[model samples]
Target chain A: MNSIVPDSSFTARSIAENVQSGEWSAVEVLEGYLSQITQHESEINAFNTVLEEEARATARETDKDIAAGKTLGPLAGVPVALKDNLCTNGIRTTAGSRILENWKPPYDATVVQRLSAAGATVIGKTNMDEFAMGSSTENSAFGPTRNPHDLSCVPGGSSGGSAAAVAAGFAPISIGSDTGGSIRQPASLCGVVGVKPTYGSVSRFGLLAFASSLDQIGPFANTVRDAAIVHEVIGGHDPKDSTSISEPFPSFLDDLERGVEGLKVGIISELMGGIDGISPEVIQKTREAASVLSENGALIEEVSIPASLYCLSAYYLIAPAEASSNLSRYDGVRYGLRVSGETLAEMNINTRTEGFGDEVKRRIMLGTYALSAGYFDAYYGKALKVRRLLAENFDEVYSKYDVLLSPTSPCTAFKLGERTADPMTMYVNDVCTIPSNLVGHPAISVPFGSGNDGMPIGVQVLAPPMQEALMYRVASTLESAEK
Target chain B: MTEPISEKEVSHVAHLARLRLSHEELQLFTKQLGAVLEHAKDVEALQLDGVEPMSHPLPMENVTRKDEVHKMLDRDEILDQAPVTEDGRFQVPQILGEQP
Candidate 1:
């Protein structure tokens, strides 16, 4: 097995293979990742919290299991990072809000529980947009996560921390939640593979809610196969989460090696044209990728979904409306930070005033207004209707096409502060990806090309809901062609 | 129909969300909110006469689990972590009013 190193060659499977075979110990893997975090933490700000001591302790137990002739689980001895939004037992799960800076959960999230049960060591928690709002990770109260490819640019967000962790080699894989474009956007910017599993495919019991209906926990890794490995560990049903699917998880590992030969592929015609702010180079690369699929015995056709143009508009309305209601639980009386005053109203005011970052406060306000009694019929209601139309449109396309493809973002990662003041511009960055979230389908971002600036560009593949196997096969084919 | 946000409305929403905005933040968010909400105008333009509002795409019923006691952090272990706590419970300034 290739020794784990701080480069593209090192991945989760590579590290796990080496660790299990006794060529490397779990401690060596932990120390290697910790050292990388120490070296690159300043450049990427990938981690919100790094508990080296606990990780080493867990690693020791893992090595003991290996030595004691215990049957090792898949991903046994692999070190992974959890997104800050995930509830980690005894770890500060801030969700990037100052309000929850010191609030540790009493229990682990289902995904965290599953990861640990599979024998993966949780190294640390990665940064995220505060409460998973905002397109760029800059909305993090802690500070922005810089891009690993170029230190001055963003790593894409609200999963920027996870993407940067994988890109900078702080960890081979990290788990992130995608409410909108959180997983795929950051993965695109950081040049990694990120999958937002089909909604209802993963349990959301311990995830900090942004838009509950749209949120799904997925994996970020340097390879599609490694993502498949991690997703398999954490993807399943839990009685605690009703929305989790009762349907069986497809054998992603088997599907990944399954060739994409003769697969019917649809390229959204509207995604190629009509969108502004797209780079010509990105369009060219997507076309090249489509051509590669065509040459590989796959059928590629141009399909149109007219409702896609309204995705951003509908998303902004629905996400905020849900966020407004979901976030109301934090009233300075529950878990986390509270600023008290002489009266209850004043206490709520002072607490929220100081606790939430500006972007979070912005969304909360926007959501509150949208869900307010009178406006609900027009704003939230209308958006839900449009969401249904988009879902229907996707069903129509998937009836003809096995999978849909587009550029993950209009361009490569932009400079960190470029669109902070322009929320519209930032929202547009999610144009190609948000439609999937609205439709509650599955999508993955696979790196396609290096732009003129040497930053990575990603092409997205969207699949009908619960059809992750089709996506893995297509993405695996593309990943092979790139190699 | 455009329900353009007024300065008064922005302040009201801020009060509801418990945010004490500076005059600068107020001015900035007012313009920003207007533009953001203006984009919401397109949402009203969508047609859905017979469509049922979907809260989640997945078809799910009550997800309630049995009330069996699972392993949980002991009160001492949990309250030991509270930034502010009293005898056995998490202590906060009287939310409804001040403590005696």
Candidate 2:
């Protein structure tokens, strides 16, 4: 019965069309994914919680809706996983932290509500770095999510589980939040398509805040078109999120297949330098990808934004500073884990010490130090100035180019425990993708080719803010060319 | 360009963050935080004499919403997740010092 639907290549569009037309039932598709999850979940640890019975109930309801001749939304009958940071009413959302181990949100995040309204079944909550803090999923309190492509290697994080779930066919699509390359880096490592939309394009309401200014929820899919389909459904304004753009968003799928003819593409020279620890294969693959676009009528040139060399430094300071403030809500008085102590202040200190992982603690301390009375101007303040300079640098380049191109990561997936020993080495993993987050530009990672140890390499396409449609066109072009 | 973070500094920052840390954690954090700060020195090397800092990428300011009544979460449902509660209020350790 399950063989009716292909396990690995089930896309959201195909499932929705077939279910709506009665060629295949939503229950059948759900069964197919459940079986896949049962088979691969232990190996990958892609999911933190699997809502088996609830998802089955939702699938049955959708089948009835289809029978009644109701018009379905874009995501009808589709099964999607969400990064655990996004709140799901009545479901435990841990953000991969022990503090929220037993916490169930009373309300759904805007994206979750939107997905449900679109007739998509909430399959489960995927794992992540504890509070979305680490470069790899190693910081997850539940456990690390291994790369589906190679179990010994890490699925880049803090969106590793979502990316791995898509790559392993647990779900056709999943939502991930990117703050300094969480989504794109993992999507690249897992050999799937991932997007980090323009900062204000998606509502952040109900997403457990992590460096709120830099975080943006996005989708991971097996195809560029599928990603765009999910993107169109989850984007737009919400009064609940003040940072959300009030402007209307065009359908991303509308211009996705449009080729990048006569478009100006810039390959960032700063990212191409071999001195930055970028593997040779990644560099070669990115250059090859550029030539393919050039042959297809897009004019390509090398552009330099020297300030981007300092992006990681600026991000490490700025993101943690924001995170320190955002995470202060977890005092023992409210929801989440509480460890008893002699007094209120002692209890607060003990609960945090017991609940947060080492990386989370490190970031919190860094933030507190940076925002301290005497040091604010030297660290946090200076990083903000650099952030402004980085944005200006990108704006200057976007004036002459439609999109910028680079390797998604300096290298392909590294072995588990490879860079975990050194925090700085792991931080460098996001060197190529961090600038996009710093400047609030939209970016996507598409698997270009394979590199060392037969692992996949991803090439990132970045466009100016609110120019997601143009970025998708170029991404789709590269995706099709790879095929 | 800046002083390396010390055990005392890590302990002080931990206190500010309300995070209790043991001596071992303090030592480890001191080393790690020092390395991270050392790397951050790159931003200080840049010459930015009079650049305005950008706290957020979007240029919008004072995004005020109209004052209107809307649906709020049920108190019972929200209190369900609280570790300890009494009469619909969160229970916590005493904030004020004990009476002499």
Candidate 3:
């Protein structure tokens, strides 16, 4: 295991280049990661499944292709982990719920197919909050993933496992979904780079639905460039997903190193000042990040989207309202855990009662109540109106600024059970990240600096829809400053 | 807005969700749900007259595809995932109640 310590600097791009040029065989890289996973998996618990044999087989084939003078893909031979919600052919795709524990999909997700076509080796499925419903991975049925930085703290959810995998060097890059900050929040906690592309930029075909309108699959990596590399490969239109954007994918890596000089950046005023529960260290780091951009010749100013203050309330309504309908498919008949009872209705009730976790059940009830006949206009309808106002507010801000910046999470990662007792407190962890999801804008969380207790703090860069290249430019600029 | 949710209301909502909860869970949810809904009252307080509800972030309408048949998942592989299967389909409990 100690033999691969020198390879820690390999980014996804460098790994592919090395493997393609025969400087290092793909098998060697795969073995190095396997060794790291073996050494760190117990304490980190980042992976729900490990595709050791499959990865080795894929690496051997990639090496053989290189010998045959074949053209290689950009991600050729890179070992990438998938969040468990993405369907992988012949692999167990559990959304960290007991219901899908033994079920394996017969087909692959569009992103999975694309990754395979690009010559990337599937490492394994990473863990997530069951159905991606919670801010902490504590809701995962398989158990929580501990933060690699400190084992006592959480890695953030529901993409905790993917972020931890990247930070712990189990893999250079991994894929995770963001529905109201699942990817960015976890990446912030784990001290890695995570991107939530503009909704519809990445095809969502085969991503397990969790608030369909908010979900978007993206990447996690140790560097901005690596995250961009994976993002380009996984993005683009898929006819299979109706919501996928029908335009050609842009070259994200081309503008990555372009720097943020002359770029107009704004600090979201609503996210700053007199906010409860925000740590002083987080505020200082955010200010320092803004200064770094300003000193680099970028223009910075404060902008407000007052309607964003209600985004949390609106998201809690819209997301669960959508989730209640999307998750209704898990009734005891077709697939998943089926608990038998005297009658069909009783069986359906029993199966759900046993299959779902507490947070999931609570959301389902909330959604059901909100969407019920009498309360629909008061709760779900009003939330939708608020959603429009938030979107309009973002539109207004984008008219004046090229990008918006904010602290990814109000505070650094806390102990595992710190806020599990109070759901609202846990929900507040997403306050800064959820607005971007609601507006369908692209956002990335870059590791800015350390906060209290030496835990990593992330600063987010948000851009209007389809402006991922600009977002990456600013992100890479911040990333280079850190280095 | 701070009205506490009744146990009966929690039970009714759980029934609508097809979820069975213990008496303890019912009481817990009644309190928790009340707190969440109380927080949610902020949305209702706004004057949203004439505001159109935005269902999706992207402004797209009925995204229909071309009418062409495509490959589907293998039947046997799909059936293998079901907990109970009959002759080529999922087997479920009888839909009609037993004859009186």
Candidate 4:
């Protein structure tokens, strides 16, 4: 019999403690979340596939380990969902694209392996954009995920489903990959704590490559500490990913209580300025967040990032160029979808044409054109220099300030199909988040307050490479201020 | 703004990208991609001849590991996902032929 009654405070931390102390079994914890998913999933549609029996079996094994006197890991019984892009051995993993609707991996992603070692239960694979391409989950081939806050609104993509899963209470934590604003944008739209650890800080061995240089897998949770716990579990160097940082990762959860006292926080001036599409409510909320941090013993000042305004242009070129090269593997023969034709080349062409969605095709065409011989210097090459400018600007600021601040998204959750017809408008949603990706910095989104529309707004905290501990400290400060 | 990409260029890029587009898709994408490129023209307008291009976020290069054999996935299991297979290998359509 369970001794402790689960309440509003029953988070990942509570669930792990209760299971470790034998107050609740791992199976019971899994069952509670499974029930929540079943009750709420139809309207929200966060997950592409829910591993009901698979999660149950894993939970039972954990219970058996406890009975056999094995010690519990940090997230002993916590249920964690995965973005569909992360590969799972023997499980059908689609990157929310029709091409790989039935594809299964031969091995687990490094993060998935690490989570298992840390005693977390695998719950489900959530939905996302086709090849993690768009800013809204509407780009998904299967279907779009409605924001949990308002069933009519979108959960920002391409990691929309992962963000929605955590927001909906279907899982205490979920994993999402950030390429540009994929993780943080959706987290803000969904009113949850989401983190994008420093580039190469977390291994990307089995993450389906979108923009390889920009991609980093991180966690989404209800609290900063929960995100920190999962971040520590999944992060570190892996030989499988050659670009992963080999340095030792610091303990983020241990550093959470350090607070923002005496910390110098710089607000990114351009993001808060009169940028188009920024709701007045979101701007007000970000200004309020600055004031709260100031009252809590931190110094705040506005800092200009001139190159940041150009990040969207540079990131659009860079990410699509990488994606066009990475997605070339979806040819008919080896795995996934195959459309037949007279010759191999024709078959490959037909397969991709039938398999990819409209948004993905537009990007591939744009990317190929950018990399073509005549235009290479004008587009892709120019974008790289702009990336360098963004990096230099960030490095100069990090020397003086511990962390920089910005609104996570220009506005809150957008209604479905609001910006679908216009591609440039959709691309504008990531303007604030793209600079961090360009410079290999770490950034996180913590919910600050709600808009006049009653939807949540997020204030982003960005830090230099390997400074996630300081990043989480600011995140925790904002989280506490909300209370 | 004027269209930054022409329909002829879009068709060429689509073919190069292994995607076959219909007349409607070609026209629609030409306008859409042109608008996107027009927005991206700011980068093109900047004079940055002195700055070197950054291709990746990480600064590391020439990463290599010891040439040691480790456990590999089973060949049969790997081959199981193939659309066409024969003689324990993936099979493909004739590459030299022009048509059926």
Of all native A–B interface contacts, model 4 reproduces a fraction of 0.88
- Candidate 2 chain A — worst ten consecutive residues by lDDT sum? A1-10
The predicted structure with the larger TM-score, 1 or 4, is 4
Q: CAPRI verdict on model 2?
A: medium
- The stretch of ten residues in a row with the least summed lDDT in candidate 4 chain A is A1-10
Clashing pairs for model 3 are none
lDDT of each residue in A1-483, candidate 2, tens digit only:
011113359789998888888888888999989998998788889999999999999999999999999877888889999999999998999999999999999999999999988889999999999999987899999999999888888999999999999988899999999999999999999899999999989999999999988999999999998899888889999989999999897778787877989999999999998337988889999999999899899999999887788889999999999999999999867799999988888889889989999999999999999999888888999999999988989989999999999999999898899998878999999899899988899999999988857787999999999999999999999999888
Superior by DockQ: candidate 2 or candidate 3: 2
- Could you tell which candidate, 2 or 3, scores higher by lDDT? 2
- State the DockQ, from 0 to 1, for candidate 1: 0.58
> Higher-DockQ candidate among 1 and 3?
3
| True-vs-predicted CA distance for residue B37, candidate 1, Å | 1.0
TM-scores, all candidates, are 0.96, 0.98, 0.97, 0.97
* lDDT, candidate 4, A1-483, per-residue tens: 111112353678888888888889999889988998888898788999999999999999989888888888889988999999999999999999999999999989999999999999999999999889988899999999988888889989889999888888889999999999899999999888989999999999999999999999999999999999999999998999999999898789787988899999999988987456777788889999999899989999988888887898898898989889999999989999999987898999999999999999998988998899988999999999999988889888888888999999999888998999999999999988889899889999999988888888999999999999999999899999997
lDDT of 1 by residue, B1-100 (tens): 7678877888998988778999998988888888889887877876678987766777758767778889766888777666567778866665554542
Kindly report the docking quality category of candidate 3: medium
Model 3 ranges with Cα > 4 A deviation: A1-7, B98-100
Better of 3 and 4 by lDDT: 4
- Give the best candidate by lDDT: 2
lDDT tens per residue, model 3, A142-232 = 9898888888889999999898888888898999999999999999988899999999999999899989999999999988988888888
Chain A vs. native, model 4, TM-score: 0.98
DockQ of each: 0.58, 0.80, 0.75, 0.78
> Which ranges of candidate 4 are over 4 A from the true structure?
A1-9, B1-3, B97-100
